[model samples]
Target: MADVACEISARGFLNSLLREWTGWSLAPAAEAEMEAGPGDGRLRIPLPSRGSVVEIAVVHRSSVGLHVFRLPFREHRAGAPARIMAFAEFAAAVAHEPAIVGPEAARAAPAFLGRVFQSLSAIEDALARAPAPGLGLHADPSFQEAERALRFGHAVHPTPRSRDGFTPEDARTFAPEYGRGFPLRWWSAAPDAIVQGTSRAETAADLSAGLAAEDPALDRRIPAAAEGRVLLPMHPWQAARLTLDPAVDALFRSSQLIDHGSGGSPWFATTSLRSLYAPHARVMLKHSLSLRLTNSLRLIKPVECARGLAVDALLQGSVGAAIAARWPRFHILGEPGYLALRGADGAVLPQTIVALRDNPFRGSGQRPAAVLAALCEIDPDGRGSALADTILRIAEREGGGAQGAETVALRWFGSFLDLVVGPLLGMQCAFGLLFGAHQQNLVLGLDDGWPAEAFFRDCQGTGFVREFLPVLAEAAPGLDLGSGHRFTAAEAARIMAYYLIVNSVFAVIGAIAIAGLAREAVLIRQLRRFVEALAGTDLPDKTCLRLLLDAPTLGSKGNFMICFRNINENTDVTDPLAHYAGLPNPLAVAPAEVRP
Candidate 1:
């Protein structure tokens, strides 16, 4: 029981007083220090700010957004006192949102607060039931059961999405669901037998080892590798929707073996690709960010999302090329999502792959500086020009110049974001930022005692807009381009922060963390350089303030990139195209290979 500290706004002060009429301790302590949790956790107030103060002035001069009060454990115990502090915060939050909680009714505050307490208790109790330390981040119930089946000799295979195929009686015998699922953990030997609970329908016949042997019912033996390597055949259903670029596909199919992991969203498996070049193997798979569930079922907008993703993937490829090209001496591998040396069977050799994770802000500890430097030295002219020209031509065929909706131009901007800003940012920030730019999306490829390379994926997380339709139409005839809308100063800043600063910076931090160094120094150094660079360049006022002030300090190494939200509409603000000024136009289109 930590000491409880609480704070409420002036508007909620009266509500608390009314509730405390029956007597409640609003303030527990006078003041307390705040402490940050271990590694990227929250920094919260350690003790109560005021003694039984329901409403008090916040230290706004020092804090931003919301005020935090530390709960003092010395005074507040688990029984009634802890409940009091928790309820106070909940009541204040509920009162503030009249639309959700409803207006102040005649009900007493304590009664209302008690209901919230009960709900919290229920949630906490439910959380205790979870198998892992954190909910939703670990294996699911199905995964657990599958592991059990494998441990016993039985194999489990999944049923296709069909109800009619299953007889009601048969379904009852196997829990109504059957299938080969991703193996979170592999089993070496099968137990003697599997015992079923009384509630489960009895399968009188003893379960045998070959149960998964293509039985008309269930098959649990999935496509696995021989000799610690498994070749997970990308289900034909999944391959049907992937980006069909020859280069992208070549890299994708080259994985020697794939093993399924826990399934929830964007189901994934581990790859032995890295094992070809490096000591430890790594996993490679397409990220499933857009795929989610809702109450309503409808046709997914695949073409629209895929187009954006394809463009993003290409841009990411371009960024990788720029880095590799700039520093030939460094071991730079350029694949779609990443590059690794694989054996003839498409299995990555462990020695060829780096076993390090990517972290951009490792304080004074340095990463493979060559990669970062190479990214910065990218021939912005050569690759950037070719991409711009290629996209315009694609837009033309897609009806670019025709005045209508801004679809063509928006799509082009999506590609542009992938190619141009993505590459440029990869240098100053590190290549991994192109991924989700969030901690979870990043992985470190360690080599020797250092981080060797940074990899990024999840295309949707990257941001770009289609404001350049008019510009493209003016340059290329017979193209459908939209009359773009100019964003206000504030709106532009917000978009940049959301897409580039906040989202992208976090990815770099994840990469930097794996370098095994204190992030503070790295973040400060990067921040200093980023701020200094942006200060000279013309940028929105608000964006500048956030980089200098609002950015979280945990692993933020200065802000390095500014996403062009209003690419065409606001192009004149800071011209990415201007970088090509006076340079020989190397992007002149050659005969492009057209697929039938």
Candidate 2:
């Protein structure tokens, strides 16, 4: 716990807090807002109950919500010196402002603030630690190195690092910022008690057993459990937490599931925290965590595991080949197999679910792959980002100075638009497949900081357009992903636009702008042109593209509301719209130019 008075990155913290605060209001809102004040580069936000207003000095502003403000936020009264307030004080006042949160923010304030403090402390810790792999040493940095570089977490999100269920020590040991790795705790389950699924002919048992054999420690202990037992690998944290559950204990007593103790080549935590990666291992393991991080429980449900296998099926069929041939630079990181244990009543245990994801970075073949979120994140210390560094490095290599740098940034962003946006839009318009192409899930294979290929992961967030079901069926007969995977054209439009345009593409624009490489509107203009060129093509379901080009407002994730309402995005299956709020479209504001 941090003292409310104790602060780290006060200006940066306040900027992020207020950004999320007013940004939420830009969409359909409960109360908080920023009123443009007399064209003086100031934002005047009123606190109705307190009868005072907060004034912020805008430095770098964006038509989108990515505004950077000058320090020392002043609270103005009817007759006061505009009292300068601390970040915590400002956060507290905003939280209690009923006009903004309708009294709900007051109740949720402490839980939210406590997590914010934890996140801030984590950032401070990350800043002090040296780059784990000696980052610049490797010509092509490992995938884990890029994952570790996301010290600040989500760009527009508050409490990006608050691991609610973790202790400070646990946060240091398990969180990606710390660059921690641990041996997995092994387990063996009777084949009857194990529920398994795979896209290929190989059984989960066969995969797990083969992986276990690679680890001599687990390999030696496996035979003792039983000759016919199925082996499973679990995160040390998940294994420890699950061992405390009564149901798990009961199963242990009955010999249905036996613990083989901890052993394996050490696996490091990735940006997602719950997902573990090992360079030597053939697969990355995505474990089900009970803790709430961000808007959802990190636990993997059977449905989510099933979704990954379905993706593998799609990738194996003609549909996959066509998508591959169309967008050679795009990749899908699908889970080939998954394993979970069943309870006494034959119910799947959520905590026991483990997903085996394909690891291209395995062995000596590690690539300079990083999620877009990491590359775009601004250093709270005002040192810019890995992306900025990459752009500048490229500029230097090409014998360029200050003016030349902007040109490099522009060209770099254009490649990103091609490699990322092209395939994502193609997936939507042509195939009627919608990927959760959020920044964190979209990893770019970088060549000297230039995006070369797109690797989209987490198949759980995928959706199929019902209108294109017949097309999908004919092309990929292997995709029978069942209910919830199918969505109406309207639902697909909202999801595709929100994920591809709002979350993923917008982050790149923000990064380039925030780094001072280019103006926000300039990048927005380029984006508009990119969309214009794509929409000119012959693809079906141009709804998302049209919305990008014409919609006054688009749907955005209401991160503030989700935290205040205590909604779990993963489990909130009924009202998926709860995650959405209205966001002013930057494309609407950026002036479009007449092209020859």
Candidate 3:
């Protein structure tokens, strides 16, 4: 395993620890004041348990609150000579310190540290088999290839790459970064056991034929399975897990469920480990899993499945058609259907659930629609990212030989504002529909190196602004917006501002800065202009815009808090919003500017 890869992961973890303590007001008055950038010096953090301080050097600062730090954290104790501590020790120290994470949260530290080590091991394992990040920089890769490109996971996450309930071999075979593919495990379920909601012309049975086509050998055998039942496909790892469940075994013996074993084309795991993709498949299959990934268990909830159908129905109605008419180039990858098994006891099996998402990049309709998270991730070699390489190429070729990278970056930033950012805000402004367009949820389609269009996915995350309910009711009379899909204006603005601007756009800005292509201040100024441009328009909802322009801070999901407390995100119903915390707003400080 490459030690440098481990070192990068280690540095990122510590940087996140410092960012949380500093940005979230967890650190004390002294420890939270460390500035980032060249010549800013190192940050010394106290390890209360060991009675020592770990000093980390600040190499670069992100305008989005997370800073890049130098590794090899040195532990300084009172009388003894200073010695270097490894990443494991650092993780333990953070858990041991109540001031860093609250006393209640510190109790969950041991569980947190276990996952941290698992994440490091997973990173090392993936790096062994995965292609070098430098390779993806130049190539116009396939959608699946781009999906496999995230070497270092979430930009600011503490345990970004960890996998729970995964053996090293299972991880290698199933994780996206490993770039491995295996056929799906299929189970045939009786009609009574199937619970399905579809907006597609083809049912799950029809889609199963598509999967069968990918493997000619399985095509003939599926006729028997497809005769009178729905063929449910599962992620191979999830299938092995369900095999051990007594509930699943009972169904198999009772003839309500029949195992079809592993068949069809080998679908590669995407960045979201539970979601699988085959190049020629008609739909992207998202199977439910019992495993915990990051902050949530991978089980697919019934309410989420219901939301996908509801959003699809809404898009097919008046509101969607109106939005499409205004932004002709804008698109949403509609999830037409979801299927799950219902136990004989009449309860939905979360593990048996699968969501069928529209696949615009699969088969004949394929294009270079790159997931923004994968594009913005720091390359494994630590040179830069795929975003850096692509943006630099745009500058070099499209800058007309006179303008520099920064100038081209400014122009490119403007186009991005129009293509991706504008419609996203416009959807909320005019229609009250909020897509959870975080880096992982949104994809950008490139045209000769420039962003030409955007695709938003994850229909289950769609939200309606409560203030605009009357307007929505009038526009789409019979539209079923779903039960808990509504958010108050303040709630909508806070979460939308974070996902769209802070989490998504800031990462794009940071990618440029981290690549040494341009300063973040310049891009922040351009972003300010983009918001001003919106100010020039007559938006239906300005609450979100107002937050971006005026608020001193925007709400951000605290990954550190979630990890420290061992919170299961999907299962948290009563206080799911409690994980959100305020992040220092960079735009509030940027000198406002507008250009015609």
Best by lDDT: 3
- Candidate 3, run of 10 with poorest lDDT: 23-32
| Tens digit of per-residue lDDT, candidate 2, span 419-500 | 9998988888888888888888988898876777889888866788898889878776646767337787777888877888
For model 2, what is the C-alpha lDDT against the true structure? 0.75
For candidate 1, give the lDDT.
Answer: 0.26
lDDT of 3 by residue, 1-596 (tens): 65665676766676466545762212232443443224335667776667877876655556576565655667889899878777677778777787788777456878988888888887887777777645235655567877888877877778888778888988778888888889888788888888887765777656765566565546567657566888887777888888788777888889988888887778898888888888777789888988888888989888888778777877888888988898877799888888787777888888888888888887745787788898888765454788878777766666544347767667767888898889989898878888998999888888766777788888887888998888877776776665437888778888889789878998888777777777788788778778877977998778888889889877777787787788888877455457666777877774743211
Q: What is the lDDT of residue 19 in candidate 3?
A: 49
Q: Which numbered prediction scores highest in TM-score against the true structure?
A: 3
Off by over 4 Å in 3: 23-40, 78-80, 213-217, 381-383, 398-403, 590-596
- List, residue by residue over 1-596, the lDDT tens digit for candidate 1: 11110211211122222211222223322332222111222212122222222322222210111112222212233242522344346344433333322343323333344333332332232223212111111211121121111110000001001122223332222211122223112111111111111101222111111112222322244412222332222322222333243432444464422333221212112111101111111222221211111110111222222323333333334543556685332222212222123344544322211111112322223332211111111011111111122223444555655331134333433332333233334332332222223322222232321233444433323332333333323343442222222343333334434334433342232222222222323333444444445445443233323433433321211110110011121123343222111111111111131111
State the C-alpha lDDT per candidate. 0.26, 0.75, 0.76
- Cα lDDT for residue 75, candidate 3: 85
Q: What is the TM-score of each candidate against the true structure?
A: 0.34, 0.91, 0.93
Q: Which of the two candidates, 1 or 2, achieves a greater TM-score against the reference? A: 2
Higher-ranked by lDDT: 1 or 2: 2
Q: Relative to the unseen true structure, what is the C-alpha lDDT of residue 587 in candidate 1, on a scale of 0 to 100?
A: 13
Name every residue pair that clashes in candidate 2.
27-582, 31-99, 31-100, 32-100
Question: Between the candidate structures 2 and 3, which one is better when assessed by TM-score?
Answer: 3
Name model 1 segments beyond 4 Å from true: 1-83, 87-300, 316-320, 323-436, 447-451, 465-493, 503-526, 534-596
